[model samples]
Target: MIVVLSAVLLFGANIAQAEEPLYVSVGQTTGNLYGLYTTSNEMWAVATQRCKDLGWKNLVFIKSADVTSEVYDLMYEAVGTAYYWSPIIGMNDLDNEGRWLWNDGTPVSGYTNWGPSQPDNHRKEDCAALEWPFNTWNDIDCGREQPFICFQEPSEYKRSQIDDRLFSIRKFDVEKGTQEMARSGCKKDGFRLAVVDSDAVIAKIEKSINWNSKVGYWVDGTHNCLNADNCEGSTSYVCEDVFPLVLSNSREDYTVGNTIEIECAGSGVSTVNVKWQRQDGVPTDNIWNEPLQKIEPGKATLIIKSATLEDSAKYKCSAANDIFSPSRGYVTSINITVHPEAIKDAMSP
Candidate 1:
């Protein structure tokens, strides 16, 4: 009887565990391994140590928009189409107020995808995270608990080859100038209008300008220099590139007996094989055998009709082609929780 009780306990524990894949290999290109932990949420400090305990270097450091886009896509694939507070990043302004810095001691500036008037420092929020759907940066309270993403980098790992752009600031004799005048002024000093490209340049520009003067400067770019455009009427303008620097940057519920559908799509390649899985904590046995219907050439849908409480588990969708393996595929997921009571009430109505 005692042996039988042990066996039953083991089986029950397995049933309680999440059945979806939580970690996907990003491959060796970045010289890093990435993992997303969603089984439980943790605060900022606890989560930081959690990554270290798991042999990760730190929380995923977002050094560029490309990195942001890639991680965002990964989150979308792994968590499905519901709103998530998301994987806590390694950015904070703990030492200095308004002086945000990455965990690696890099200042936060330039090419920021901040939600409208974000990082307002609401309630002394020092930590930073990427909000879902919009994929914008937000300052979060470090004490808040949330799922986190971790990256493991080797000791010999180096920064990416794409360098950050830098610039020198030139304050005009008279504050507030026209676009052409700003350009001419910069050209006079053997420089063109300041092309604000990276965070380093933005820091320099902010430091050189007089915030109290309320003067405008001419900057060459829009959307924080993601594209080329001339911004007029600024106190000071920036010169050409001086050097290279580096910098970085929710859920839905379901009722029981309802049909659940999730769409998985892949781009950048012409064709892809999409697969769905339930996180089982094992390398194998997670491959979901549910038949997927190809909604489009590179897209597929996972549908479960008349869902039950047994379907309440994290589900992941992966898309891959010949160029990429399932481990390095475009993946997304949706955590579904079915409510038996809600379903029953709806059925009664």
Candidate 2:
């Protein structure tokens, strides 16, 4: 009883049993409850499993920015001035040093709060923890035992799958996440990661989804920046190994001198560029390609203007990106024909 009193004084609040939701507040979801429980000298691995079996006690690996702030406060109240685990959840460069990732193998979204001179990789330390004196991150060895926190994951923001050219991980749980989970998430929806390359495509994606500004959106720019770094200046999140698929068809017919249009199906919701070529290998130059999209029902439109007899040919449209190599580019064959004016008039009746 005396020892418990001292610990509560140290924490500035009475320490409760780990199973109790002492600080339950409105979280991203209904069932989520945040708590920092003392393990009385349990190692990371032991604590992880014990917590899971006890309940939904996955080690709290926070990713949401807004949630992080609220959690910092909750953590302060829970631990007062003590170090606790953060799960600094992300991919670790097992092949290389100084690289990290989210649990799903997607790069950590954005805004990492590494403690000063932290991630020093000291003694091969890989996992992260919120160090005391301030809940900044530090890459620490995973074997050490200490009281750890199990907090709620990122909030489930609404996502929209647009035009099979771009995809976002919808309803992802921080617990038991993998890159395949994020990638295959798009796969299940018949899409892939929306690769960011140009300002136009970037702009289109921004317009397509109502991404929570409070949280960082995962936009990989390995080729868009094309400077070796996934990002322009400091590399943040890099693209994953997800390739888009074709979900729609691109075949159309029209009268001579009339506008003919065809839309290449997207591998999934993502961004893509389509180039048209004649059956005889002549690139069609009279076509205007632009992204016509909306969130209600995500779609990208491609248009061929003022079809003429010369436009009668089998055209090919392929979507390509560097995320997946060997250029197994998704191909769409469009057969465009200008109905003879006589035939058009005859068919009009």
lDDT by candidate, in order shown:
0.55, 0.44
lDDT of 1 by residue, 27-78 (tens): 2234344567777788888888876665467787877765664565566555
Q: For residue 7, what is the lDDT in candidate 1?
A: 8
Q: Give the alpha carbon lDDT tens digit for every residue of 30-97 in model 2.
A: 32335555535445566566546544336665666545544544543333333334432322444457
Each candidate structure's TM-score, on Cα atoms with residue i matched to residue i, is: 0.42, 0.34
What's the lDDT for residue 286 in model 1?
27
TM-score of 2: 0.34
Q: Lowest summed-lDDT stretch of 10 residues in model 2?
A: 1-10
